[model samples]
Target: MSEKSVSTVVIDAPLAEVQAALFEIGSYPEWLSSIKKADVIERDGENRVLKAKLAIDAGMMKDRVTLDYDWSAAPAALSFTMDEADLLTQMDGTYLLKAIDADTTQVTYELTVAVSLPVPSMMITKAQKQTIDAALKELAERVA
Candidate 1:
């Protein structure tokens, strides 16, 4: 329920390519630095990841979180909510993609996080922005 931190980046890739990269959740640790490991817990009928367990270690923030993904919006958007975590009380995120051109896509990432430990609001917000920026950059690199 906390305010979400949002960031948008334009990637030099087609919408389908970007969506493909995003959908391969298990491969995230290979590109996303903060994510040390990603294990798919469940998959939908289409083989899309419906639940995943992720091990994250981003400097001051480190936790193993299990998340439930909502893929009803597919190709255009993907959203996830944390089902369980050691340190994180609430972790919810969404990725919105828009085709800018035949070879370009605009990606917007929105995240809201609340920790069990006491942390300043400003620090948490800053960390969230940094995480989003890094994720976007890595995603772009992976797709390109």
Candidate 2:
């Protein structure tokens, strides 16, 4: 079965700054522990990554995943879907950013992933939370 998780964090940075850091895929390994490597396969005219390959190691699971990213301009949300992966059958996620004030922003991360191996539901949930928390914590440091 597939599992989904949603978590939010408030970063002490402007929305634009936070968005910039998030979109800097090349620098992901520096901030995101799970991402071992990231390569941009395709980009829009605006130079944003439309397709990319990611190598990740998430403790209990590891996979080389390719994803297609979509961005919304009005509300400033970036969503992605898994295009291919050896271990992952399906995966999708979104980063929704809202400006709390001039210097604070709230980031809501929603993720769903299905792995090839059968893992306990409780373990999956715990892993998801750890992944989200670590990402947000490192991101906050990067932009701060």
Kindly report which residue stretches of model 1 are placed more than 4 angstroms away from their true locations once superposed. none
Candidate 2 lDDT at 144 equals 95
Q: Model 2, poorest ten-residue lDDT window?
A: 69-78
Candidate number with greatest TM-score: 1
Candidate 2 per-residue lDDT, tens place, 5-71, comes to 8899999999999999998776788888899999999988888888999998987658999999887
Scored by CA lDDT, what does every candidate get?
Answer: 0.94, 0.85
lDDT of 2 at 46: 80
TM-score of each: 0.97, 0.94
Q: What is the C-alpha lDDT profile of model 1 across 20-134, one tens digit per residue?
A: 9998999999899999999999998899999999999877679999999999887789999999999999999999999999999999999998899989878888888989999
Candidate 1, which ten residues in sequence have the lowest lDDT sum?
Answer: 118-127
